[model samples]
Target chain A: MTAIAGKQPNYKVAPPKSGMTIKQQALINSIIVNAIVILLVLLWTIPTFGLLVSSFRPRDLITSSGWWTAFVTAFQSGAWTLDNYRSVLFADAMGSAFLNSMLVTIPSTVIPITIAAFAAYAIAWLEFPGRKAFFLVLVGLMVVPLQMSLQPLFSLYQATGLNGTFLGIWLAHTGFGLPLATYLLFGYISSLPVDLIEAARVDGATPMLTFTRLVLPLSTPAIAAFAIFQFLWVWNDLLVALVFLGTRADVAVLTTRLSELVASRGQAWHVLTAGAFVTMIMPLVVFFSLQRFFVRGLMAGSVKG
Target chain B: MRSVQLNGGPVMALFEKTWFRVLVSLVMIMALSYGFMVSTEFMKNQDAPRAMLAIVAILVGVLGIWALYLTVDNLVSTFPIRIRDFVRPFVFIAPAAIILGVFIIYPTIRTTWLSFFISRRGTGVVPGSFGLQNYVSLFTDPATFRALINNALWLVFVPSFSVSIGLIIAILVDRIRWEKFAKSLIFLPMAISFVGAGVIWRFIYFRATFGAQIGLLNAIVELFGGSPQGWLRIEPWNNFFLIVIMVWLQTGYAMVILSSAVKGVPGELLEAARIDGAGEVRIFFQVIIPFIMGTIVTVTTTITILVLKVFDIVFVMTSGNFNTNVIANVMYQQMFVQGNFGRGSAAAVILFIAVIPVMVHNVRSLKSRRF
Candidate 1:
């Protein structure tokens, strides 16, 4: 099943001879496929590429001309500048918002993985009452609209003074992230060799020791995958941050801050372009660096039950 | 504590007693909760060094939970062996269950309850205001009606477009040498937030009235001697434009999954189809697609759920202006902007109801796989 013969040059089906040989037909087919794929790739990338180019162009140039114009004058001294990024980072206070995103994202990722790993181990291995029912309910909860929980959670936060605090957002992210984390981890933990777990038990390893020493190490790939998913989700989240953290400058993360910039300065493309890239830069780095693990996590988390 | 053994003296025997162990567990839980409260209180203090306080709070919250779990697990071990087996699972599961119950399960119930009442202001429901008035008005209101229609359009277009485009790209890219690089470029947008994507597309859809036309679309139009257009102000079609952005961001996700599934289809099966005189298109329809139908359903439903709750795109690009209101954005408007709790909760409940079928399907599939 893993063999992908279609990628090979020699894997073409023989076409009935008409005006040309079968080799020529295969060549034509390959060229057509490559052209179409390249065109689609360009279509998918140009929007992001436009903004990226615009971010580096000077403010006057960005407003007065198309980003494509900068490429015509690519080596000219006046074509590019760091002024937009400078103004965005320091003048617009995205620097603090960037830090705030980190503060909110890290603990949110760690706490959920920690909590859900324990729960997944229990659900997978332990002889618990209602284990099947609990697992089923968690699966059902995976698709529950976050909108359903917004108002009441906001009310609860207001009552408890969790609204607009770092602690509140952290706990809120953990709670919302738990169902998927536990479910994904459970899939991995349950599929571990059963005899390995039984071996530890027979050798007098306690559940806690077994989990820490054996399960945790063996499950690093699953744990790392969920960490990236949760990290990206929390970092890029807007609704949760808006509802729980509000648009308060001190607590605003990158999404809330960037959205606020869009609202208040819709015409300021210079700042908006740089500001948008600022928010995107981290996720892009994580994506390019950890694309393999991210894709594995996405498939395991979504495609499988 | 590590030095102590099961063979220790009477003092250890007291620790092993079921009643004493239960007391210790309860005390450990309360202590953890107390520590959390105190640290959060410290966080609430404005005079404290903000970063330091945040760090301390994180340490306390994380460490405190871990400490509670360890203490409880240890206590469970001292119980009779049969009881320990059962109690230990609950001990492992308690934190997750409590948080889910409090954060997700309870709020869902409360939101449903709130939908049954009326609240002009978000303070609380009015006395004697128990009825279906909120839902009735929800279905009747003009603005919300537009939102419902837009949501329906999103539900139809986003998933179908994303899945089809992704599937085509998956199949085409697989036959090429630079498959990984091309896939990464297409999939790059998935790393971007919806708000950031909105900003990126705003540059494309940006309309310049009196300039060289910085937006690419406007630039192309002007290059052909046509005037720039305010693309977002056009009614109904503007909704389609916004939906396009979602498709752009989500197509990569669908592509990645569908690509893997396409690769998983057996090479022998394709060869067999070719031997039977089936063309490539015919083979794709007959052999390849049917082989990955399960994955297609999975990708479609996943994208469908995302489309159902789409908010950031509309919220950022137009704030639901120009007839682009979706259910989630309208729910935000009623609840937060208008401070009308009842209407908002009713809107939220509509989203919840829309997702129920997907949820049930997911649970059923999971059960079938496991049991």
Candidate 2:
């Protein structure tokens, strides 16, 4: 586990202490484990710091005072206001629903990592015929339930007019993100080193030139960790963009335009706290700039399913 | 004849004619199915110039499937090499097996054959409405038996309080020292959006009837003097305040996968179970919970298949409305707000027979890793 989450454990092998000796019982057990991990990291960061301080206070001091009283009226003057992020980014359009959540998360994360990296390099280095029954039917279609294919793929995308387009929610998020992007790029292109795909097939090349010049550049860190896990599962998808992109406003997206501004500005807590921080500023800037390839592609997809 | 007269005579004898390379691979699969029907009709038009023709129809539908797999690998290298190694791994597994057989295996066998029949108002499916009357009105529907006991109390309290508060914040942030800045602030609500953590826990379960209580859980229940309540309309504890917004958006994906299985236990087996005297809570339940019990059943069956398709925290907090519904928000209120396609394909075939025992324990642990 990345060597115990990157070292620091050897507390001088302290166990046999008595009468508060071993460095004062390891400084009272590191101040009772850093005060219960800073009180469970302040109860998991005070409900996202009380909706990012009621999305910068204003609207009548956020429904008459309480985002912990704007840290005790910190320099009062109508305490904080980017006019609730300039009226949820230009008067509630949430800046074209943040360009329709980057037009439905950059081609639903580059057409499901280019059709699951050509079917995970043909089920990790081709052989052909039913290839282990198409990799155990892509690990039994990774636990099927997208409510059993959303009502017959919404009546086959309303009979091919592909219900609310953008190439029908980018071919329905490349068939619900191709069975966990061909089972996490076939667990990193079937653990590569088969003598570099038999030295690009004994030099003659061609399995489409050894999968586009030897397994697509040694599977770019499992295709950039399943492209940040299919761009934060198609940018925090709200039921596959509300059943294949619908709630219209120029093809809604930032979680279906922040769940229609929490059902038509639910008590306009400053336009649902600056429209839920403009649909959480691109999955919190791709979860804090690729948090180690989103926790190593979420522990290589929950330690292989 | 002599390498077809040194490879250029009548274009290498019409590319070594096997009926002229199967009529040029059936005219390049009918011109790549008429360039994917004119870029899916210029990505469903919307007054043209659409963001430069939908970025040139998403770069010709992802480089038109890599130019139809490099023209079917140069028409399977003009075949005849034992049918070019038996049609080249179905040309790199036919566009991910025809888009996972037309979007998830033929719409999960056409929503389990439209959950056996009868569909009225939302039109279609009627003619001699088949049998098992929509799984007997989805087990005699009292609002789908309160969405099957709020999807079995969100499958037993959202995977046991998101794997026991993500295995106690992955063993108290693996004994701090800013353990990666407190495990990235409890995995920052797994990067928000369950409708932006249901509008940040609907502003900490906001209640406010008259004055003060601007919901930080009704201003700490009106600073301990009690009063304010409606934490998502109380009935049956508003289904555990909508299963504490799916255990606060799945306890940071069970604390970053049980903090990498509690830093994969082994620190000389926790200093040989603290030199045999074993204390630190009995070396965390006998040596780091039996050495991260296979990453705590792989983060409790990957949060029990994401709390059995929970559905955007009860469709953005209580759209299930007091006495919260679940089986994927009653199969999206019986298929798109009461259109009732045979009780929403029998509530999506009871969430595909409750995800066939976690898809046969993830295909028997991917056939015991014999990938």
Among these predictions, the greatest DockQ belongs to: 1
Report model 2's interface C-alpha RMSD after superposition on the true interface residues: 16.3
In candidate 2, how many Å is residue A31 off? Answer: 8.5
Residue-level lDDT tens digits of model 1 in A1-305: 32555454444456547878766887999999999999999999999999999999999999899999898999989889999999999988899899889988988999999999999998998877798999999988887888888899888888887777888888888888889999999989999999999999998998898898899899999999999888888889999999888888878899999999999999899999999999999999999899999877666655211
Q: For model 1, what is the error of residue B125's alpha carbon versus the real structure, in angstroms, after optimal superposition?
A: 0.5
- lDDT per residue, candidate 1, B1-371, as tens digits? 44347467887877757788788878887887888778879876645666886688668767877897898887778778888876888988988999999989999999999998888673678878989998888788888888999999999999999999999999999989999999999999988999999999999999877677999988999899998889998998999999999999999999999999999987788877876678889998989999999999989988888888899999999999988999999899999999999999999999899889888887887887763
User: Relative to the unseen true structure, what is the C-alpha lDDT of residue A37 in candidate 1, on a scale of 0 to 100?
Assistant: 97
Cα lDDT tens digits for candidate 2, B2-111:
58777667888887777787788779878987988887787777556557756876777688778888877777777779988888888778878888888888888888
Chain A accuracy as TM-score for every candidate? 0.94, 0.38
**TM (chain A), candidate 1:** 0.94
Q: Looking at model 2 chain B, report the run of 10 residues with the lowest lDDT sum.
A: B45-54
Shift in Å, residue B31, candidate 2: 3.3
